[model samples]
Target: MHTLLKNLKVEINDKLYVKDPESSDLGKRILSCSIEMIYELGFEQFTFKKLGLAIKSNESSIYRYFENKHKLLLYLTSWYWSWLEYQLVLQTLTLSVPKDKLNRAVEILTQEVTQDSNFSHIDEVLLNKIIISEYSKSYLTKEVDIENKEGYFAVYKRLVLRLKDMIKEVDPAYAFPASLSSMVIQGALHQHFLKDHFTAITDCNSTTTPTSYFLNLIDQLIISNGKK
Candidate 1:
């Protein structure tokens, strides 16, 4: 993880520190620094000075691209979701059967969570912190609240819609419940991070990979839904 962070820092520095920088390249570099800052320091701890230092630029340069830290955080979150959306779209294109598609989606998502060093450490912590902090502050926005409407929500909604479509395809007689499935999937995928808590509650072995367990649960859900 440290090595990955170091490499990302070097990459950003190279892109932003050129003697003659292209406008397009500089924009990307600042965003990259914002991402790195969010990863290194939790979002709450992230500051413009740190980002500026990371990219070999100034706070004024960053503000030229993003109006404020909130906007930069939004941009970072957008980038994360956009990448996820691309991956999901690619996975969707390759599968014909709905059940198979859902299975593949689950596999792909779990694998991503397990494999992404950045996500495994930084993004996951930031996500949990945001949820907890925002939820407690009475800031939990409705699904379609305009103020809360962002790229992350859009990607999440699209995933749920796709899952709903898959459910309908697999079992047309039953009403497809997306909320349940979405919750299940999130809980499953993040189980690795929550292993200790899960172990305390379920008294299960702490060493098991959550992704494997998640896949098993998804299979059972599909079978159960098929019967209904």
Candidate 2:
């Protein structure tokens, strides 16, 4: 129920869908129901047919929005990264401190997510879960290069590069800005997965601790490492 932005579009790659899902009511329903069903049933079991039934639309209508489940997955992942890019800018731009901005970036990557009510069809919290669990499937396919060529990976690359800039601001001499930034983002996602599916692999006993752990780790790597 964030009230600041009212129904703004989080643009995804146009090629991921046969038709734009945000352009019409049925398309919107396709998105909303797909997120709901995917979150409930998991990406492996979720299908356009099942999603169509959830929204009381025909399978053909769902197909109009996406080529297959994989495209829908890419569309969802692209949307999430786009949303994250906006949020990172919004949360960090006001700060005058480099470490503070970097710390804000860590929190966004690691902290608990809430459902963003702005996009009524998309549950960001649930979509985040899908990203943590099922995102690899999008790239693990044989068509990954083809998908990349279609702009499926653009938002993710942009997000990582923007965060990489914050790392360089903290330490211009840092040798691995891109590597470090991507590590923090993907590491946090891995921690979430471990905490949920393999508790013994992670020490986060509560929801808030992942944010602390990641921030401290970033401080060690970026802030403290710069001093040495």
Candidate 3:
């Protein structure tokens, strides 16, 4: 697990929030409770009004930080990707070998998320659950193009690029590094999604935990320096 410095706030895009939610007690409450409420109630059923009541703040007060629930979801998912990218960087950097870095990257990306002690206001473990169930809603929308143009996906892209670099370091001549890296990342998550929501669809999960299964696939698919 990545150690979060005390009160280490991950600043998301200003476009995701009207005002920085981490700046005030109420703002922090909104962020903290929103993750909890959304995880409990699902995003479709979660509302600022419910959040306002839960936190004992007025509904209008919640509007000061986010324009709408979709934006809040955007903010949450954005923060998640940023946090994940940070973990990938820290985990991979301490390892010297190129193949080891690639392996560590996939391992961190695929494993079940655990709560970190450093980011006190955010429950990352619950947030990871939200990502598994609700994140696609943030991007699979009519405004996705506009949001993409405004760089809403920057953190996720940065992660893919980091993985792409590690893949290239292992296999300079390999074609489709970006696609391969993204497949591993997204495929791991989707497999988890299937396991939790659609039990009968995925069978390979029967053999091993998804992380171990995917790591083995990585080793099989790409023989770095033809070592495999």
Candidate 4:
């Protein structure tokens, strides 16, 4: 899978950026440094000025790639989802059993992220941490509807739809496949956040992960519903 993904490019909405960050060294540096800075300082405290200082480049240079920190966050989240969809598809492509495919899909979506050497410029693990911690700020705005029409979240929606289809295949009688699919995706992020900060409220811990919890939940819901 790593070999197949070596040359893969995770496409993002061009409208999210003034310039393609992957096109030049400076632009890539902006993305790489911004990820590190955002993870270190959190999104509210992250700024292009801080990113510029971190990368030792002018603030104006960062602007060439992203109009503002909000757009940069959108770009990063979009990239993460697109990259995830690639892995989900490749990893589950050969599974002939619907249940097996669905299980793999859940694991892929909820599993802990590790750094991918294929994309050296971006740290996927840190990006996943950002998604778990700061993703909501990207869309919890008055302009979300406008941005939705502009397709800022198309990749994420498509990923959910892919899982929804798998759920339907697993249990054609299940009436809430789409709802369950979206919940699993969002719930995984929420559970990860809970485990990291509000540990007392969540069952997930060092011994168990969000992936394990969701796998059990899905099997009970889908399989039990199918039995009826």
TM-score of each candidate structure, all chains considered together: 0.67, 0.94, 0.93, 0.97
> Is 2 or 4 the stronger prediction by TM-score?
4
Q: For candidate 1, which ten residues in a row score worst on lDDT?
A: 9-18
Task: Choose 3 or 4, whichever is better by TM-score.
Answer: 4
- The predicted structure with the larger TM-score, 1 or 4, is 4
Better of 1 and 2 by lDDT: 2
Tens digits of lDDT, candidate 4, 1-228: 767898799899999999999999998888898899999999999988988899999999888889999999999999999999998999999999888899999999999998889999999999999999999999999999999999999999999999999999889988889999999999999999999999999999998999999999997989556532
Q: Quick one: ranking by lDDT, best first?
A: 4, 3, 2, 1
Off by over 4 Å in 1: 1-23, 113-144, 149-152, 196-207, 224-228
Give the Cα lDDT of each candidate: 0.53, 0.84, 0.86, 0.94
Question: Taking the tens digit of each residue's C-alpha lDDT, what string does model 3 give over 1-228?
Answer: 333455356768888889999889889899999999999999999998999999998999999999999999999999999988878877776799888888899888888899977788899999999998998899999999999999888888788889888888888778889998888877877888988878788754655667887788778767534442
Candidate 4 achieves a global lDDT of 0.94
TM-score of 1: 0.67
What is candidate 3's CA lDDT for residue 127?
A: 96
lDDT for each residue of candidate 2 in 32-98, tens digit (9 for 90 to 100): 7787788899998998778877888788988877899988888999999899887888788789988
Best by lDDT: 4
lDDT of 4 at 15: 100
Best by TM-score: 4
Question: How well does candidate 4 match the true structure in TM-score terms?
Answer: 0.97
User: By lDDT, is 1 or 4 better?
Assistant: 4
